[model samples]
Target: MQSTASTPELYLAELPEERQHIMTALRDVIRENLPAGFEEVMSYGMLGYAVPHTLYPAGYHCDPKQPLPFMSIASQKRHIAVYHMGMYADEKLLDWFKEEYSKHSNTKLDMGKSCIRFKKPEQVPLALIGELASKMTPQEWVQVYESQIKR
Candidate 1:
């Protein structure tokens, strides 16, 4: 995966064939589920969706040119990771998501603080992933970032 400095289109074009397939599928799923404020961009060597600053000036703090990312999709060496912003401060929701994932996914879903890692596309539960993606609204994402700083 290329760095965020790479243009989103270039990054997509440069992805390995396998990773490109995974990224494209993930991108379509995410785009279909996320709200209107979410715009695709390259961040941390992956595709990420963020809110435009015109909607919230304070959304871009560290980088005035970039908006606040709520979710991201990365191509790791052995797997793809779906990064969720909800884990930043919402432990209860995070735990609930983990439990829900495990309950329905038969223990195949692997997750960390915010990233859900999986090697094969078949291993991913599309419906459950969609549910998880829907949890963090733009307002909830801003709250998570603020609470993260407090901690």
Candidate 2:
């Protein structure tokens, strides 16, 4: 479910107690591993990592006032989700993630174009997620967004 929380801390606080640790861990992993230039912010009511306007003043094509989103994490009704725009814009990244996920997780990967869903918190592979977070730099993401996804 989309959260109305204004800050990352508030977003974490709003999560159910059982989900707090995993979500916080996911946030920490992303923060520690994401390449420099991506700022952590609350976007679209979720915890978001984005290329700030200072870096790319064009901002998001869909909403210029908002930063260009690179990744986001949210607690859905039935699952916790990680959305990585790199996987959606780059097929090789998607293929690599699918392959690596098989190696790291015993459970089948549940995913959409950009959203990776984990129904069980124990099944979340933190290290793999960290590696994925580190895979794309903000400049690279902005380039990809301009070339591939932006209109």
Highest-scoring model, TM-score:
2
In candidate 1 the C-alpha lDDT for residue 120 amounts to 79
On lDDT, the leading prediction is 2
- RMSD, every candidate, angstroms: 2.4, 1.0
Tens-place lDDT digits, model 2, residues 93-132:
9999999998899999999999999998998999999999
lDDT of 2: 0.95
Per-residue lDDT over 1-151 for candidate 1, one digit per residue giving the tens place of the 0 to 100 score:
4455467667667777877776777777788888666678777677888876766677666776778877888777788788887664688778788788876676466777778898776676667666777777777777777777667
Candidate 1 steric clashes: 0
Q: Name the lDDT value of residue 109 in candidate 2.
A: 92
Please report how far candidate 1 places residue 6 from its true position, in Å.
Answer: 4.3
lDDT of all predictions, in order shown? 0.74, 0.95
Pairs with backbone N, CA or C atoms under 3 Å apart (clashes), candidate 1 = none
Q: Model 2, stretches more than 4 Å misplaced?
A: none
